[model samples]
Target: MPQDDPRDASLAVKFSPPQTWTAESVDGLATSGMFLAGIIMVTRNRILAWPSLILGVNSWINQHPLRTKEGGTPPVGNLALAFFALIASYLPLFLKATAEPAGATETQTPLSFST
Candidate 1:
Protein backbone atom coordinates (compact mmCIF):
# COMPACT_ATOMS: atom_id res chain seq x y z
CA MET A 1 0.00 0.00 0.00
CA PRO A 2 1.26 3.50 -0.86
CA GLN A 3 1.42 6.07 1.96
CA ASP A 4 -0.28 9.43 1.43
CA ASP A 5 2.20 12.28 1.00
CA PRO A 6 1.41 15.45 3.02
CA ARG A 7 2.49 17.51 0.00
CA ASP A 8 -0.26 15.94 -2.12
CA ALA A 9 -2.85 16.90 0.47
CA SER A 10 -1.68 20.49 0.35
CA LEU A 11 -1.76 20.41 -3.45
CA ALA A 12 -5.34 19.14 -3.42
CA VAL A 13 -6.36 21.83 -0.95
CA LYS A 14 -4.74 24.50 -3.10
CA PHE A 15 -6.60 23.35 -6.19
CA SER A 16 -9.98 23.26 -4.45
CA PRO A 17 -12.42 26.02 -5.19
CA PRO A 18 -12.95 28.68 -2.55
CA GLN A 19 -16.63 27.98 -3.21
CA THR A 20 -17.36 31.66 -3.04
CA TRP A 21 -17.20 34.52 -5.47
CA THR A 22 -15.02 37.45 -4.50
CA ALA A 23 -15.86 41.14 -4.73
CA GLU A 24 -12.80 41.72 -6.87
CA SER A 25 -14.07 39.33 -9.52
CA VAL A 26 -17.45 41.01 -9.60
CA ASP A 27 -15.83 44.42 -9.70
CA GLY A 28 -13.65 43.39 -12.62
CA LEU A 29 -16.69 42.24 -14.56
CA ALA A 30 -18.49 45.48 -13.73
CA THR A 31 -15.53 47.49 -14.95
CA SER A 32 -15.48 45.62 -18.22
CA GLY A 33 -19.21 46.19 -18.66
CA MET A 34 -18.82 49.88 -17.90
CA PHE A 35 -16.06 50.16 -20.51
CA LEU A 36 -18.18 48.42 -23.09
CA ALA A 37 -21.13 50.71 -22.30
CA GLY A 38 -18.92 53.75 -22.63
CA ILE A 39 -17.67 52.59 -26.00
CA ILE A 40 -21.17 51.90 -27.25
CA MET A 41 -22.46 55.21 -25.89
CA VAL A 42 -19.68 56.93 -27.77
CA THR A 43 -21.18 55.56 -30.93
CA ARG A 44 -24.60 56.88 -29.74
CA ASN A 45 -26.10 53.41 -29.69
CA ARG A 46 -28.67 53.48 -26.88
CA ILE A 47 -29.81 49.93 -27.55
CA LEU A 48 -26.37 48.46 -26.92
CA ALA A 49 -25.53 50.93 -24.16
CA TRP A 50 -28.64 50.03 -22.15
CA PRO A 51 -27.72 46.36 -22.01
CA SER A 52 -24.11 47.09 -21.16
CA LEU A 53 -25.11 49.51 -18.43
CA ILE A 54 -27.48 46.92 -16.99
CA LEU A 55 -24.69 44.34 -16.97
CA GLY A 56 -22.36 46.72 -15.14
CA VAL A 57 -25.00 47.64 -12.59
CA ASN A 58 -25.80 43.98 -12.03
CA SER A 59 -22.13 43.13 -11.53
CA TRP A 60 -21.66 46.03 -9.14
CA ILE A 61 -24.67 44.95 -7.10
CA ASN A 62 -23.25 41.44 -6.94
CA GLN A 63 -20.04 42.77 -5.44
CA HIS A 64 -21.76 43.19 -2.11
CA PRO A 65 -20.80 40.39 0.27
CA LEU A 66 -24.45 39.81 1.13
CA ARG A 67 -24.99 38.55 -2.39
CA THR A 68 -22.40 35.79 -1.95
CA LYS A 69 -23.64 34.48 1.42
CA GLU A 70 -20.11 33.13 1.88
CA GLY A 71 -19.22 34.85 5.18
CA GLY A 72 -16.61 37.11 3.57
CA THR A 73 -16.47 40.85 3.96
CA PRO A 74 -16.73 42.92 0.81
CA PRO A 75 -13.40 44.25 -0.41
CA VAL A 76 -13.35 48.05 -0.12
CA GLY A 77 -11.18 48.60 -3.17
CA ASN A 78 -13.36 46.39 -5.28
CA LEU A 79 -16.52 47.99 -3.96
CA ALA A 80 -15.25 51.43 -4.81
CA LEU A 81 -14.18 50.38 -8.27
CA ALA A 82 -17.48 48.64 -8.91
CA PHE A 83 -19.46 51.62 -7.66
CA PHE A 84 -17.47 53.90 -9.92
CA ALA A 85 -18.12 51.67 -12.86
CA LEU A 86 -21.83 51.61 -12.09
CA ILE A 87 -21.95 55.39 -12.01
CA ALA A 88 -19.87 55.71 -15.15
CA SER A 89 -22.12 53.35 -17.01
CA TYR A 90 -24.97 55.86 -16.67
CA LEU A 91 -22.91 59.02 -17.18
CA PRO A 92 -23.57 59.28 -20.88
CA LEU A 93 -27.30 59.16 -20.31
CA PHE A 94 -27.10 61.88 -17.70
CA LEU A 95 -25.01 64.04 -19.99
CA LYS A 96 -27.41 63.55 -22.81
CA ALA A 97 -30.32 64.48 -20.59
CA THR A 98 -28.63 67.72 -19.58
CA ALA A 99 -27.25 68.61 -22.96
CA GLU A 100 -28.88 71.17 -25.22
CA PRO A 101 -30.44 69.78 -28.33
CA ALA A 102 -28.53 70.21 -31.57
CA GLY A 103 -31.33 72.33 -33.05
CA ALA A 104 -31.67 74.50 -29.94
CA THR A 105 -30.41 78.06 -30.17
CA GLU A 106 -29.82 80.62 -27.48
CA THR A 107 -33.02 82.52 -26.70
CA GLN A 108 -31.18 85.50 -25.14
CA THR A 109 -29.41 87.23 -28.00
CA PRO A 110 -27.64 90.64 -27.97
CA LEU A 111 -29.98 93.59 -28.45
CA SER A 112 -28.10 94.58 -31.60
CA PHE A 113 -28.39 91.04 -32.98
CA SER A 114 -32.12 90.90 -32.10
CA THR A 115 -32.64 93.99 -34.27
Candidate 2:
Protein backbone atom coordinates (compact mmCIF):
# COMPACT_ATOMS: atom_id res chain seq x y z
CA MET A 1 0.00 0.00 0.00
CA PRO A 2 1.30 3.51 -0.82
CA GLN A 3 1.56 5.96 2.11
CA ASP A 4 -0.24 9.30 1.75
CA ASP A 5 2.15 12.25 1.60
CA PRO A 6 1.51 14.76 4.45
CA ARG A 7 3.46 17.47 2.56
CA ASP A 8 1.21 17.06 -0.46
CA ALA A 9 -1.92 17.56 1.64
CA SER A 10 -0.51 20.70 3.27
CA LEU A 11 0.54 22.14 -0.10
CA ALA A 12 -2.92 21.50 -1.52
CA VAL A 13 -4.56 23.33 1.38
CA LYS A 14 -2.13 26.24 1.22
CA PHE A 15 -2.43 26.81 -2.55
CA SER A 16 -6.22 26.64 -2.73
CA PRO A 17 -7.68 30.09 -3.33
CA PRO A 18 -10.11 31.58 -0.83
CA GLN A 19 -13.71 31.61 -1.98
CA THR A 20 -14.27 35.11 -0.64
CA TRP A 21 -12.68 37.98 1.16
CA THR A 22 -13.08 37.81 4.95
CA ALA A 23 -13.68 41.55 5.24
CA GLU A 24 -16.98 41.39 3.37
CA SER A 25 -18.91 40.27 6.44
CA VAL A 26 -17.78 43.21 8.57
CA ASP A 27 -17.37 45.81 5.84
CA GLY A 28 -20.80 45.15 4.37
CA LEU A 29 -22.48 46.04 7.63
CA ALA A 30 -20.25 49.07 8.05
CA THR A 31 -20.98 50.35 4.56
CA SER A 32 -24.70 49.88 5.07
CA GLY A 33 -24.63 51.80 8.32
CA MET A 34 -22.70 54.69 6.80
CA PHE A 35 -25.05 54.81 3.82
CA LEU A 36 -28.05 55.09 6.10
CA ALA A 37 -26.39 57.80 8.15
CA GLY A 38 -25.51 59.70 5.01
CA ILE A 39 -29.13 59.67 3.89
CA ILE A 40 -30.18 61.12 7.20
CA MET A 41 -27.54 63.80 7.03
CA VAL A 42 -28.50 64.67 3.48
CA THR A 43 -32.06 65.28 4.57
CA ARG A 44 -30.83 67.48 7.38
CA ASN A 45 -28.37 69.45 5.18
CA ARG A 46 -25.39 68.76 7.37
CA ILE A 47 -22.26 69.19 5.26
CA LEU A 48 -19.94 67.78 7.90
CA ALA A 49 -21.49 64.35 7.66
CA TRP A 50 -20.40 63.78 4.08
CA PRO A 51 -16.69 63.37 4.73
CA SER A 52 -17.06 60.60 7.29
CA LEU A 53 -19.64 58.88 5.16
CA ILE A 54 -17.20 58.99 2.28
CA LEU A 55 -14.50 57.57 4.51
CA GLY A 56 -16.66 54.67 5.61
CA VAL A 57 -17.50 53.85 2.02
CA ASN A 58 -13.83 54.04 1.03
CA SER A 59 -12.93 51.63 3.81
CA TRP A 60 -15.51 49.12 2.63
CA ILE A 61 -14.27 49.42 -0.94
CA ASN A 62 -10.65 48.86 0.05
CA GLN A 63 -11.51 45.73 1.98
CA HIS A 64 -12.24 43.79 -1.18
CA PRO A 65 -9.62 42.54 -3.61
CA LEU A 66 -10.30 42.37 -7.34
CA ARG A 67 -10.66 38.80 -8.53
CA THR A 68 -11.25 36.89 -11.80
CA LYS A 69 -14.51 34.96 -11.41
CA GLU A 70 -18.23 35.79 -11.42
CA GLY A 71 -17.27 38.79 -13.56
CA GLY A 72 -14.64 39.44 -10.85
CA THR A 73 -15.46 42.90 -9.63
CA PRO A 74 -16.85 44.55 -6.59
CA PRO A 75 -20.22 46.26 -6.87
CA VAL A 76 -20.62 50.05 -7.26
CA GLY A 77 -22.07 50.69 -3.84
CA ASN A 78 -19.15 52.87 -2.80
CA LEU A 79 -19.20 54.92 -5.98
CA ALA A 80 -22.88 55.55 -5.57
CA LEU A 81 -22.33 56.64 -2.01
CA ALA A 82 -19.67 59.10 -3.19
CA PHE A 83 -21.95 60.50 -5.88
CA PHE A 84 -24.85 61.01 -3.48
CA ALA A 85 -22.58 62.60 -0.93
CA LEU A 86 -21.20 65.05 -3.46
CA ILE A 87 -24.68 66.00 -4.61
CA ALA A 88 -25.95 66.38 -1.10
CA SER A 89 -22.99 68.46 -0.02
CA TYR A 90 -23.05 70.72 -3.05
CA LEU A 91 -26.75 71.05 -3.85
CA PRO A 92 -27.38 73.55 -1.12
CA LEU A 93 -24.51 75.72 -2.27
CA PHE A 94 -25.74 75.63 -5.83
CA LEU A 95 -29.26 76.53 -4.80
CA LYS A 96 -28.05 79.35 -2.63
CA ALA A 97 -26.06 80.79 -5.50
CA THR A 98 -29.14 80.90 -7.69
CA ALA A 99 -31.47 82.33 -5.06
CA GLU A 100 -32.88 85.86 -5.24
CA PRO A 101 -31.06 88.49 -3.23
CA ALA A 102 -32.67 89.58 0.06
CA GLY A 103 -32.61 93.23 -1.12
CA ALA A 104 -30.09 94.16 1.56
CA THR A 105 -27.11 96.09 0.22
CA GLU A 106 -24.60 98.54 1.72
CA THR A 107 -24.64 100.81 -1.35
CA GLN A 108 -28.43 101.06 -1.48
CA THR A 109 -30.41 102.88 1.17
CA PRO A 110 -33.52 101.43 2.80
CA LEU A 111 -36.77 101.37 0.84
CA SER A 112 -38.20 104.02 3.20
CA PHE A 113 -35.26 106.33 2.42
CA SER A 114 -35.48 108.45 -0.75
CA THR A 115 -32.49 109.34 -3.02
lDDT of each: 0.55, 0.56
Per residue, candidate 2 scores C-alpha lDDT tens digits across 1-115 of 2357665654465466566643234456446646755774557555545664666566656655534244443445555565566666666776746554799555865569558
Instruction: Give the TM-score comparing model 2 with the true structure, all chains together.
Output: 0.42
Give all candidate RMSDs, comma-separated: 10.8, 6.6
Q: What stretches of model 1 exceed 4 Å from their correct place?
A: 1-23, 26-28, 65-115
Q: How would you encode candidate 1's per-residue C-alpha lDDT over 1-115 as one tens digit per residue?
A: 2457665654465454454543233356656665765566455555555556566556656655534555544444444444454556556667747678899887966667543
TM-score of each: 0.33, 0.42
Model 1 accuracy (lDDT, Cα):
0.55
